[model samples]
Target chain A: MNDVIICRCEGVRLSEIEQAIREGASAVPGVKKRTRAGMGPCQGRVCQRVVLQLLQQPPSEAGESPDALQRSRSPVRPTLLGDL
Target chain B: MNDACDVAVVGAGPAGLVAAIEAARAGLSVTVVDEFPWPGGRLLGQLYTDPRSHGRWDGRKISRQLAQEAGELGVRILGGATVWAVGRDLSLELSGVPVGTLRPQALLLATGAAERALPVPGWTKPGVVCVGAAQTFTNVHHVAIGRRVLVAGIDPLALSVAMEMHHAGVDVAGVVLPPVSTTSGALASPERAVARLADVADLAPNGLLRAAARLAAGKLSPLAVSALRFDLVRVGGVSIGFRTALVAVEGDGRVESATLRSVAPDGTLVGPERRIEVDAVCISAGLYPLTDLAEIAGCPMVEVEELGGLVPLHGPGLETPLERLFVAGNLTGIEGAKVAIAQGRQAGCSIARSLGRATLVSPEDAARAVSDARTSSPFRFQPRIAAGRAAMAELWQQAIARGDQSA
Candidate 1:
């Protein structure tokens, strides 16, 4: 899982997110700023929730509350200026 | 350009197209809007052969026919226009680029459903994608998602996608389904949960899969004997939908393998977890209604467990509480395209009647269309969805009553 890349856009791995959490990135945005997981073309549609889990729990525990997962973000579609 | 039209329908999918066509037939100036360049929502990406009609009712063909009919009716299509906001006055805010204020006398929000991904440990890997995304990349873009793939989940969508991938020469190792007992947060009450389970059971591929498996084992029934005598690959390939549950996916860099376990009907894990190596993993857990536009337009919505999520509350006529505002298709529920089309036609005719046109879709035609949709589609979840929707509508009324007392 450490070698496996979770954020395809940022090229970030699971370990990097965990390391950022270990280094005091306790929230989704904090991990995004610390580890570059959500700063991608997709704008974190894919990785932010996974980042949240890594931020909230230690790696070995491997547990995150699906029921307690945060709400889906707004403006569902990605907006590129040129496309607009 | 004129700022007002007889009707402006947002979304150009199956539901939207049908609504626009029906509205035009009623002698209305109809405008159909969508964010995509194409008209069909899920239809263009679907390629499943109808099991009942022996491959006659093609997905792509039906979608093409709807788009063509809409065009022939002089329906205007506005592609790539994203709706930013909609006022009570029916004034729409475009994405800061399209120069138009759509002030239609009637508005139909046919905005369709989107994929609902259930979380898995390795779901975020590079090669992991929703099954709909796989279908879109292959059918629409002429791009192969992966050379070898493992699809996870059960439903017509999963099997249809696996079949499509197999047709495209991708090695679809197998499709995996979770245990029937595995429920989503969408199911709230026990009664609704049990009803949805029955609906899933009625549509489950076990009978077909078992029949195919017996054919594989050389104990084929007379009807199955012919299917085996003709082609064993198709039967065997589709039969994989049974006998598996996805526990987790183990991967490195990209999707390297998916961990699966066999499960029984009683929700008991039957075998040791096994990992099958594959380049990609696609999950078709199911879809929830896409209701952002309906929400932004301020339509009252309630969580219908059977329909999969919170959906706009509407009367049987598909008219929202908002005046002259209507909704159809998956925006109301997750009942597939056939039902969506029927609801669209119903909404269109309802809108036309409100506008004082009498003969757009006759009463008999409207009844027939809805009846056909409820029973004709390959997938059958109408009973569960109908009950859930009715309960939601009742809940809405109770809330309104409470609000009135409070005010």
Candidate 2:
């Protein structure tokens, strides 16, 4: 099967996310760091929940734990560099 | 716009507008901020008939009424304004139309919900979109998504949006089930999807369609599944492809055609895949609470499957762990718009009480209104909402006991 795009903003593929999960990415932030799924302009608004569901898949040696959201920082909305 | 107000309601949807109205009525200066160009949030796209009242309930009209009421009560609604950053001290840094920071005494986050994504092979294509997004374009913006559309996934939202599109003179090619996957759950199976569809069968546009839906939902459900496996059923002139799953979409830059395959009663792919030419494909994966703002504000979030997803811990009065931060509407959980309005009223009253002010409606009364609205809600998005609410209350109690304090 073709690798479906998971992160629309960054064009992260599902295979990449699966590889990240195989490489001990148990949570959204971990996946974001490894695959940049939630590191796009929308900042995970579109792909965060999808990544969370993907992380909840079983048989993970990373051990089960509650999911955590990425810490939201300043300029939550897209702002121009001059605006800052 | 004023730099600050007594209360800042972020959304301007049914919940935020009602909350602002109640708070302003209590003599608290209220300001509302919304990212949308208009004040009405998701309500702008809603147009349905009340199964009880048998009258059309246009969401855009209701939104205008609420927005007007809030304005009469002296609420400042900053449409097209985005709260880019929220501070622990109830300070909101906004952009767009009103480009400045405003510090309010209390903050109410009614950020609402977003559609869940059901990604297929060609979902990223230009003509592919969510059912709600299509609804917004067709009903709100008066823009047609496509000349002919194939809607995948059989849910209340999908069915309703299909009907709305049909009424708007769009050729709704068919409604099919999504590909069988872990995330698809009940919708993956034909039998389960039929049962779930039967729950909201009354919402069908015409009586004949409603009768068919009820029959399919009732003792005839098994027979309906068999029929679906064999052939398609036309409901209200729109083809209902039962036992059929959309496996993949094939297109060049835009949606061109979708691959449909027959599924067994157990939701396993059975027959050969067939391609149907379609300009648009609307995936209805369902909805989840938009908790980005709550997460940003550092509110404690708990996962409640029945509520659709992770929601902030809030009391019956919609008060969060943060002293003056409250959440209402879909942000708390996925419920109908009426329940959101009731919750808004309750949150407004709670905010008034927390601020030690007198209000027209007591918090208890507002709470009762919420219960009333919940019971009377035509569409119960989640069947186990009561259970979700109970679990949330327990979580709130546990969080309090553990002293999980937040800023």
- Model 2 regions lying over 4 Å from their true place: A58-69, B182-186, B202-212, B219-231, B405-407
TM-score of 2: 0.94
User: How far out, in Å, is residue B149 in model 1?
Assistant: 1.0
Instruction: Put down candidate 2 lDDT per residue, B85-145, tens digits, no spaces.
Output: 8887878888886448888999999999988887788889999989999999999989989
The regions of model 1 sitting more than 4 angstroms off are: A1-76, A80-84, B51-55, B179-235, B238-243, B262-272, B363-368, B381-383, B392-407
Candidate 1 CAPRI grade: incorrect
Worst 10 residues of 2 chain A by lDDT: A57-66
lDDT of 2 at B300: 72
Instruction: Provide the lDDT at B379 for model 1.
Output: 62
For residues B1-407, could you state the per-residue lDDT of candidate 1 as single tens digits?
23678999988888888888888898999888888877887777755445455554455777778888988988888878777557767666555345456888889998887765555667777888898899998887877788888877645566567777777788888765642322222222222322333444333333433333333334333223332222113453553534466667776778888887765433345668788888888886567677766776766666565665557767667777787788888878777677888888988898888788875567568857875786656565344676766675676566556552121
Global lDDT of each candidate: 0.66, 0.82
> In terms of lDDT, which candidate is strongest?
2
* Model 2: lDDT of residue B88: 74
Error of 1 at B70 (Å): 1.9
Question: For candidate 2, lDDT tens digit of each residue in A17-71?
Answer: 8899899987789999998887888888788877777777542221112365566
RMSD, one per candidate, in order: 7.9, 2.7
